[model samples]
Target: MKNTLIESFVFLFERELDKLEAEIKQYPDEASVWKLEGDIKNPGGNLCLHLCGNLQQYIGEQLGHSGYQRNRPLEFSARDVSRAQLLNEIQKTKLVVSATLRKLDDESIRQMYPEEVLGYPMTTVFFLTHLLAHLGYHLGQINYHRRLIGR
Candidate 1:
């Protein structure tokens, strides 16, 4: 069960990374950083940054003790980060999440998550599953955002 969960999470992360790559290829470099007029909020570059920081902080640091520090606000506020840099961060995040999950035993998977997220407590496996869902949700948004504005 633990192995299955680990495999599924890794697969999802990979898919997310692939979608980001495709978005980078499809959208104009400037469009990648553009938020639509009015209340659209959060361009693709920020979403990519948020995804990297979230996984690095939650899974890598909290669970695997990887010593990552998350700057949550910066994840949304920073702008004009290059696609190459974002892709590189995504690759690094994949490595961190993969290494962290590989080190976990079944017992560790069943243990409580290291911190409260979304104002609740849950097991490590449960939190990881939630994080996977979060990744997919944002990946879809990025896909749509690219299509909505891409040339």
Candidate 2:
């Protein structure tokens, strides 16, 4: 029963992640990728990269794999990524995330992490939820920025 619930949550999360990635891939790279509107907090590609980086990092470590390079510069460095490239990256990340979540049974989720990892006290579950929320918030920002800069 518990396993089913966790899997369901993970499936739903992955579904939402897929939706956001699809929306982002629709962005016109020439204009929308680097456009930081006057009021927007972050550009579209940066937000996408942030989500991508964090997802890659967390899912990789949790699955006993090496993570993406924690290079903040690369997130924003490529301002002209083609839509196909962006979507391809997103697809790769989605597979990683889905696999990680699938393996995280209730016991694994209940596992504790060293406080040093987070700079504060938090269980693995807490961190997982935090990352999900972080991704969603940034995705919203990207969507808003898209509307503002997109025609």
Candidate 3:
């Protein structure tokens, strides 16, 4: 079960990251990636940065011990990041997430996460599930932002 579960996670992460890359690349222009629509605070570029930082921080640094240092503020504050750079970051994040998850064994997946991310203790698998959901949420937002921007 654990092996299958881990494989599923790896596949999902790879697939979603690919989707994210597509979303950013599909933006009309570099400016469109950072354009803010009415009532919306975060743009597509920042969302991509946030997702990269998030997975790198939690999975890469904490689980995989890749020693990643996250600049949480920069993820949202910085703007106009080139699509090329964003795509590179996305690919890097994909590698980190995939490698980290692949290393997990059955016992490791059920163990408590290295940090109390949600203001409470949770199993590694649960936290990973949450991370996947979070990624999807922002990916959806980016998809919408891409379509709605440049209007």
Q: What TM-score fits each model? A: 0.89, 0.84, 0.96
74-134: candidate 2 lDDT, tens digit per residue = 8867676666667777777778787777876777777774334568777777777777778
| lDDT string, candidate 1, 1-151, tens digits | 3246666666676677677666766677664555664566987788889989999999899988998989999999888777778878888888898888778766778889878887898999889888888988888878777877664
Comparison by TM-score, 1 against 3, better one: 3
Ten consecutive residues with minimal summed lDDT in candidate 1?
31-40
Which regions of candidate 1 fall more than 4 Å away from where they truly are? 1-3
Model 3 weakest 10-residue run by lDDT = 1-10
What ranking of all candidate models by lDDT puts the best one first?
3, 1, 2
Which candidate do you rate higher for lDDT, 1 or 3?
3
* lDDT score, candidate 1, position 14: 68
- How well is each residue in 22-120 modelled by candidate 3, as lDDT tens digits? 999999989999988799899999999999999999999999999899999999999988999999999999999999989987678999998998999
Error of model 2, residue 52, in angstroms: 0.7
- Candidate 1 shows a clash count of 0
Error of 2 at 50 (Å): 1.1
